[model samples]
Target: MRCPFCGNLETQVKDSRPSEDGAAIRRRRSCQECNGRFTTFERVQLRELMIVKRSGRRTPFDRTKLERSIAIATRKRPVDQEQVDRMVSGIVRELESMGETDIQSEVVGELVMKALRSLDVVAYVRYASVYRDFRETSDFAKFLGDEGLSDNEDT
Candidate 1:
């Protein structure tokens, strides 16, 4: 690695440690020329995963976009922030396990739906309504009918 201080090409690693997330290696290095010390982090560069939309359009995967949607759906709900964080982490893990650079947006949505369904029914419905673009009340009714959720669960 090139030294950041004097653009020296030679450097020696003084120490190394794994980052808390375990996704990267933190290394302390000293420049051979200037004796300047600096820290460098090395992380595995994952391949760009393309999200294939329902309209056959491909877009880059965005974590913030996913978080925002889930957050909006979970607003005013009893679900804790930790649960949301875990749900997001689980989805990322599942996606990474696919071992493919390209994934369908529908697949991501379905994963989130399944996770949210067991976590909070209200949040699940909110997310589904936005995701499915429910045109009328009948759409929600159909979902309720299909899932067998009724007024009894509301209390």
Candidate 2:
């Protein structure tokens, strides 16, 4: 491994173990030249996935961005971090196993909506508002009605 501190190409792995989620391998290393220590994670990439945006543009799939958005939607909710991670991992695995590197951005959004729907209704609604670009209160009302959820207005 290349050492980030001194740009040295030689580094020795002092310890290695599977990550908490078992989705990646974490390795602790020391630079041979600078003796600096650092940690790195290795994840298996089935292929380089590309997202075809609605604007006729293409961008590389970013897992962290997806996770961040989901986290934001679920923030302050009763949902835990582990459940969020599992949803992210499941979505990634589903996309990878589709056998096509190019996927529509809408497809990804729908996947998140479906995953969040079963996890928490509030989180699902939160994600849907952003993903569907809700612009008014009626938008939320209609969505809730369509989903068979009641809106209790404390008048």
Candidate 3:
């Protein structure tokens, strides 16, 4: 592996173990030239999954992009990084197990909303605002009502 710190070509693996979810292998490595340490993860790619956007455009599924969106929703909240990772992994697993190479972007958005809803209400609302494209306060009011929540609920 290439050392990220010094751009060294050679690196030595000091330790290896399965991640908490058992979906990836975590490896601790040190750069041979600089002695800088870093961690890496290895995951199995079952197949190429494509995301079909609302515009009818097809693009490859990106886990990082999903993570970023979730992070933004959970920002400044009590949610932790591990929970976000688990949510992303769970969604990917669900998508892969469906036995479909192409999935709708709407499906992904709904899954995220579901996950965030259970994790944190604030994060859920934050994500829903963007995903549902709320243009005004009534949009949020309607969503809250539909979800059995009152707009006066304590934040």
Ranking by lDDT: 3, 2, 1
Local lDDT at 142 for model 2: 95
Name the candidate, 1 or 2, with the larger TM-score value.
Answer: 2
CA deviation > 4 Å runs, candidate 2? 1-11, 30-38, 152-155
Candidate 1, TM-score vs. the true structure?
Answer: 0.69
TM-score for candidate 2, residues paired by index = 0.83
- Best of the two (2, 3) by TM-score: 3
Candidate 2 lDDT by residue in tens digits, 4-33: 999999999999998777887999999999
Global lDDT of each candidate: 0.86, 0.93, 0.94
Clashing pairs in 1: none
Report the C-alpha lDDT of model 1 over 12-126, residue by residue, as the tens digit: 9999998555655889999999999999877554667789998999999887798788999999999877688668767877887899988999999999999999989999999
Please report how far candidate 1 places residue 66 from its true position, in Å: 0.5
For candidate 3, what is the lDDT? 0.94
User: Candidate 3 lDDT, tens digit per residue, 1-155?
Assistant: 88999999899999999998888999999999989999999988888999999999999999999999999999999999999999999999999998999999999999999999999999999999999999999999999999987858774
